[model samples]
Target: MKYKTKSRHIFILMSLLLITSLVAACGGPATPAPQAEPAKMEEPAQTEESTQTEEPARVEESAQTEEATTEETTETASATDSTPDSGSVELPEVDPLAVTGDIISAGSSTVFPLSERMAERFQDEGYGGNITIDSIGSGAGFERFCVAGESDISNASRPIKDSEVESCQSIGREPVEFRVGTDALAIAVSQENDFVESVTLEELAMIFSTAETWADVNPDWPAEPIQRFIPGTDSGTFDYFVEEVFDKDEEPILSAGNLQLSEDDNVLVRGIQGSPYAIGFFGYAYYNENQDTLTVLSIEGVAPTGESAEDGSYPLARPLFIYSTAGIIAEKPQVGAFINFYLTYVNEEVIDVGYFPASEDTLSVAEASLLAALK
Candidate 1:
């Protein structure tokens, strides 16, 4: 009975030792190792996934910023190059004469300075071969221009008369009219003549006509004889003075052959400037050129100037004209170009040359009319 009891005790001790060893081996090999390996692997995977997501988002944001910047830069560049800041566009660079082809322009000697300046500028810009201009009396110019196929342009101090238009139409041509600027027909005397200050329209008529002496027009004036220099019958200036001041009536003194007549306003200026008692009338440009030697007389107590002329305060103000043939513009590219350039530069250029620019509304109407006629 003692030996059997001892064998059972030994078997029990062996079973307990085996169970403890198995538990330690299973726990060591599986529990702690699985937990450590899963944490290490999962941490790296999660970090990589987060890194990939953030990189793509950052790249997209950077691309969007770059695209927006590029678009803004492009828009700014386009705006700077296209629009004119001053509301007026710089004229496109073009050879004015070359664009027009061969050009022929003739007109009022009074309108000569502006035309000559334009022609000179055109030539300087390489248009010398394309343009030729002449300064003839306004009536003579119209007479030639009205003849069908005669001339490309006619410059005039006055608008085309109904009779002149009929003359053009009779020859199978129509004249398109353009107003370039305003003029003040100034009555000038020698700078030495201090007796005269101002005169009314009625007084001008009397002074130009039957009044042979200054004292005849005004009893308080000097007794010296008043010498007169008048433009010839073919001058538009003469016609304007006749119509505006004389009521188109024939001057008895002019009919009596007492008035000195000349086609050249320069000659008239010379005649007046040479004689202290002499008086003559011409366009403001001529008066401006001879301002040193001549004294401009106020009409109805109003001086002739750009402001006064524009406001109708100057009685002698008149509209200057450019008459173009419709047929010429159709057949000649130069004629169209010349007209366009003239209209484009006239506002500033006309004023630069001692003439008044037309109002903006008038210029707009003229440009629209010319463009439509060209079309």
Candidate 2:
């Protein structure tokens, strides 16, 4: 019975084994193969981390670069905006007939004739406004224009003094200098005097100062008393003379005997023409106007000609200037118009008035000054 039972169990085991083999053949495997989903999931996680961190950092870097570029552009624009206008400034044209209002100018006696001529022409061209010009000395002129604030313009032979400029500022005015023409300071003697045709700078200084007689200056000259006629201390001409001849020391010339000082060049001219021993120095225009009675002495072998003055060869050649404030120009439109006309037509009348026209460069600068005042 035991052997029969063992044989039956072996048969059943053999049948079960055959069934399992058939199932394994039909399906591939009972347990599932390791899934690729986990590796794919890890890849997505890494990609998300890169987008959140590394990609944002790159984007942030790009944003920073853009910000730097914007700052650079702003700085470049600022730098450009701060630069001064160095290009040519356009001068406005004047229609004198259409303008109206009074204009007052006072200053140097040397600039008086030129300013007077311009004023006449402005009126002749149909300007209806009254233009008053006073022939006060430069110091007095500045006193009126800067300190008292009475004049619209100030005429000057020499540059404005710092103290005068400060005075202008005290009255809410900033004086602007406009170069109008050039003048040679004429050292003249009576036409009847044939002894001196020229003089050295040293001899010229002595004749105006220490020398008591013509013979004291030169042995060949006659022993006549030196009659010295000079511009007054208030005159710009006086200031220039003292600066050039006396090393800015006025004591020598001021204390000299036979010295006569006048604000009017006409007075000096008449005084100088009275005697052969008489000598005086004033603007070339005064000498030119009275050339028949006066003989202009050459200094250091250089005469006061337009050519010599323009070329800077003449030692006493000086620039003639007119000064006005921007406030005045704006307050009086007629003043602006008149200055425009003067600057535009100055050359036409300057030569005829016995003064040299300012150089083209200088005229342009004058035009620029007018332009600035108008603005």
Candidate that would win on lDDT = 2
For residues 87-194, what per-residue lDDT tens digits would candidate 2 score against the true structure? 444454456666655667778888989998999889888887567777777888899889988778899999999999998999899999999999999999999999
Q: Please give each candidate's TM-score.
A: 0.73, 0.77
Clashing pairs in 1: 100-334
Instruction: Put down candidate 1 lDDT per residue, 1-375, tens digits, no spaces.
Output: 999999999999999999999999886777756656754543321211222322324433433444433334334434543643333333332344334235666668778787877766666665533354556578887887886345678889988889888888998888888888899999999999988989999889888887877898899888888888888777788888888888877565376324788767777999998888899998898888888999999999999998999998998899888888656665554565567678887886887777888887667666655554554
Candidate 2 CA-lDDT value: 0.81
How accurate locally is residue 284 in candidate 1, as Cα lDDT from 0 to 100? 90
Segments in model 2 whose C-alpha atoms lie over 4 Å from true places: 1-89
